[model samples]
Target: MLFFSQFQTPFWFSSCFSRTIILFVFVVMCCHDDIEAALVLPNNETIPAIYVFGDSIVDPGNNNNLLTIAKGNFLPYGRDFKGGPTGRFSNGKVPSDLIVEEFGVKDLLPAYLDPKVELQDLLTGVSFASGAAGFDPLSAESANVITMSGQLDLFKECIKKIKAAVGEERTATIVSKAIYIVCTGSNDVSNTYFLLPSRRSHYDINGYSDFVAGYASQFLKDLYGLGARRIGLLGLPPIGCVPSQRTLGGGKNRDCYEAENQLASAYNAKLSGLIDDLKTVFTLPGTKLIFLDIYYPLLSLIQNPGKYGFEVATVGCCGTGLIEASIFCNPTSIPLSCPDASKYVFWDGYHPSEKAYKILTSTIINMHLKEFF
Candidate 1:
C-alpha cells in the first residue's frame, strides 16, 4: 500500500496555504492509491533503447568525474533513489531515467561516464548529458562541464564501442531504432543570457533566442547524421518561475518572473518551428523529429500545484528553496529540506521533484509515443 505523510504547515500560515495543503494530501491519498500504479507506463511500446543528451535536467551523472561544481553525487540529492545520489540532479530519477523507465526500456539509464557501465548496459542506452551543460557553448564553458559538441563526440565513441561489441548491423539497429532525447536550452536562457551579462550585451532576448535555436538545429542535424532517426527535442520550461529565478528576479515577493517566461516562450516557438522545418529538410527515409513542449505543463503545475498533488511550487524542497542547487544543495542542507518531496514540485532550486518528472514523462510518452512509429 502507498503511504503519504500528512502535510505540515506553520500555524501562522494563511488559510489558503492550509486549504492547499489539505487538498494536496487528500488528492495524493485518494488519486494516487498505489504509487507504482501511477508510474506504470500507459502503453507497451518498447524501444530498443533511449539515448539522452543535454543539461542537468536529463543528466544522470556525467558530471561526476568532471571537475565542475555542477556535480550532484552526494547525500540528500538521491535520498529516494535505490542506490544513492549517482550524480543525478534531482531527489530521485531525472527525466532521463524516467523516460527510459516509462518506455519499458530500463529502470535506470546509466551515465556513459560511469565506470561500472558495461557492454550489456551499453546495449540498452546511456546518458551523455552533463549537469549545467547547455546548447550555448558559453553556457557549458562557464560551468566547466562537457559541451554539446563534446557530448556528440562521446556519442560517436559509444557507437564505435557498440559496433565493436555487437557488429555493425546490430549497432545500426540500436542507434536508429532507439529514441534520442535532447533536453537543453534552459541554461542558455536562464544562466547564459539572463544571469551572465556576456550574451545579453551582444544579443537581446530575440537575438539570443535565434542564436540558441541555430545551435539547437545544428545539433539535431548532427544527431541525425550520426544515425539517430527518432528524436525528441525538449523545449525550455518556464524558466522564470523556478525557485532560483523567482528569488533572483521575481521582485520582493518572489513571484514568477514574466520577462524570463516570455523569453522561454519565444525560444520554444522558434524551436518548434525549427523541428517542423528539420523534418522537411532531413533526406533520411525514416527521420522523426519531435518538439516536446515542457513549458506549459510545468507552468500549469507551478501555477496550480494543488491540482497535481503538490503544495509548494514557488519554493523547492531543498535548502531555502530560493537558491540552492548542485554543490550548494548538499548534505548540510538536508535539515532544511522538506521531509516529503512528493508534495513539492521542485527537488532543488532548478530541477523538478521525482513525482513531477514522472507526471511530465508520462504525459509526453502518452501524447507522442505513436508519432515515433
Candidate 2:
C-alpha cells in the first residue's frame, strides 16, 4: 500500500490513486466556500438555478407519486443518499442533483411533484423528469409515465407558480438565466423502437432516429419560446452497453449490443446537427444551446474501467448485476447487493453508480462550462 501525509506528499502515484484524489478533492470542495472559489468563472457570473427535464437519468423522485411501474422508491435505490430512498433511480444522487450541487446552487434538486417542495425550492428550480420517459410520446405512454409534452405542461405550471411567488420579472430572470438540462431518449431507443414491435413495424432504425430527433428539436424550440435561453441537452449514452441490454440483446455470451448502440449514435448525430441548426434558425438572441455528449465519456469508462478505478463496468452492483433494475432490484432478491458500490460503474442494470455519476458530471461540466457562457 502507498501512503502520504500533508507535508510528505509524493509527486507521483498510480492513475487510480490520482483519480481518487481528484474525486475526493471535488467532494471536499463541494462542502463549503471552496466550491464557490473553485467554480468561479472568468466573468464571475453564476447560474441562478437549474431546471431539469428528462427521463430516469435525471429524475429524482417524480415517478414516486405517479401510477407507473418506472418507480424507484425503495431500498437499495437511495441507500447511499442521506435521506434514504427518495425515488432516485440510482443508489444515491442522480445527475439532476449532482449538476445543481456542482454549481453550488443547492444540495438536492427536488422533484416538482414532491410534496416536500416549497416556494423557496421553486426559485432554485425543481426537476420535471419522470422515470422511463422519452422524447417519443408512445414510449412514456407504454410505460405509464409522463410524456415529454406532459413534462412541459408541468413546467408551465411551475413557471406560473414561480411568477406568482416572485412576480413576472424575477421569474423571467430566473427562467432565462438558469440552466435547463434535458437528458432522455435512452428508453426510446432501448425500449420503444427495438424491444417493442409497434414502432419497428412502421419505422426502421434510421427512421426512428429521425422521428425522435424531430420531437427533440421541437422540445428545444418549445423550451426556448418559454424564456429558457441557456439549455444543456445531453446526447444518449451507450444504451446497448448497459447490463440489461447486454442480457437481452448481447447474445448468450453477453457482449455489447451494437445494434442499439448504432441507433443511439445515429440519433445523437441527428440531434447534434439539429441543435446547431436551431441556434442559427429557431433560436432568438442570447440563446445558448449546447449538445452535451455523454456517449464517449461513458463509453470510455466502460471500455477502460481501471482508468477510472472501477472493477465491474459490464455489470452492476445491485443483486445479480445482469438483469435486475428498478423494481427488479430489491432487498428480497435471492442474493443481496454487493457490499462495495465504489468498485462498480453501475448501481443497477440501468443506472450508473453515484461514483460514476460524479466522474461523468465532472467531465461533462468541464467540457461545456465555458461554452454555456
lDDT per model vs. reference: 0.75, 0.76
lDDT string for model 2 (312-350, tens) is 998989998998887898776426788878789888888
Tens-place lDDT digits, model 1, residues 1-373: 0000000000000011111212111111235521221322223333677787888877878889888898889988999999988998888877777656644567888999999999888888998987777778998899999989999999999999999999999999888777787888777777778878878899888898899889999999899889888887777888888898899899999998888889888888998899989878886666778777677777787888887788899999998898998898999999999999999988888888888876666555544554554
Q: How many residue pairs clash in each candidate?
A: 0, 0
Off by over 4 Å in 1: 1-46
| Reference-based TM-score of each model | 0.89, 0.89
Can you list the residue pairs that collide in candidate 2? Answer: none
Candidate 1 RMSD computed on C-alpha atoms after optimal superposition onto the true structure: 9.9
Q: Which RMSD does model 2 reach against the true structure?
A: 9.0
